[model samples]
Target: MNERMTKQPKAIQAIIFDLDGVLTDTAWYHYRAWKALADELAVPFTEQDNEQLKGVDRLNSLRWIAQKGGLALSTAEEARLMAQKNAHYLELIQHMSPADLYPGVQPLFAAIKAKGWKIGLASASKNAAFVLDRLGIAGDFNYVADANQVQNSKPDPEVFLLAASGLGVAPAHCIGVEDAVAGIEAICAAGMRPVGIGEPARLVQASLVVPQIAALSIAQLQALA
Candidate 1:
């Protein structure tokens, strides 16, 4: 946990979640789609290249791939390519079900709801609702702020802030759960406590770092506030 010099909020009234790695393991589908597109374009995209796409929006990720491939395109070409990639991604994730949810996610949702803390989803994916609906967890959240609602991506705080606002909670009164470094930064920037669900070394700045969502508890989360 990161030491804080400032006084922290007293109670956690809401919990904001990132929908990708934090809720489900859809990153593999994202990578596969991007990789397929890259192959078609003859770009040397590796899993390592896909790491940079975490928390990035679709068009921007395509732009990064284009930059790496040394390919330039007009505005119209960019839009078409982005649409193609999204189609591929959608096809790959079409069969997702509740079973596709990450371990401990369902139990965690039950626990959070039992505690009466409002739940909000903040994701850079424009397809957040589609994925959530497929996973059968769309009704679990009290509010959702997807890529369509925000102009800026993670590390900019816009998405998380919007989620907090949607929940009718102050940013300081919420806990943001994430599985990406950019997400942690965004939560902190939004003045919310960050609970990182990944490697501690990479999430040292988070208020709490857990190996997985299953390891999280309402007691552990309340301690942070």
Candidate 2:
């Protein structure tokens, strides 16, 4: 189905968002936590390696780090490592406030809700609910489909599909905004319009690539959808 370049739908009834890099800047905390673990293990994890973790699950990211360190782990060991990383990340984000929301995020959310568009959050993080609550914006979304609710992560299309279903909107009638390659692919594969929120080159597959969500408008989004 050449999902990489699908046609936009005539209307966008729902806007599904990825939590970390999109609505908040928790990606930095994820990277810092991973980096701390890698350092403790004497692994050569760099910022570039962290980039590869975007839209990927916590355990998978740990696995990738282990692969870089040339280590194989038992299931229990992997679970321990995953828990360690998550604990570090959770600690880092415990101090987050609504001030952590990206510029224009609240206004954009308000504008979208004002237009009666359903908002859904589709994030790989199990802490998505906590983050939203801490930001005091938990009520902003119509529904949330996080890692706990999905068996698969981004690039599998499961999360986005679930978000669309939760929003009671057809996939074709939803627009997904993401900042990672896997997320954009998931949106496309889910048969929804993909709106990239980062580098244009990295998200050339999206229906519309913008520098940030603040740069997008309801009219622009509708037209793209």
Global lDDT of model 1: 0.91
Identify the candidate with maximal lDDT: 1
Candidate 1 segments exceeding 4 Å error: 1-9
Clashes of 2: 0
List clash counts for every candidate, in order.
0, 0
TM-score between candidate 1 and the true structure: 0.94
Worst 10 residues of 1 by lDDT: 1-10
Give one digit per residue, the lDDT tens place, for model 1 in 25-71: 88889999999999988999888888778888888899899999999
Off by over 4 Å in 2: 1-9
Instruction: Please report how far candidate 1 places residue 94 from its true position, in Å.
Output: 0.9
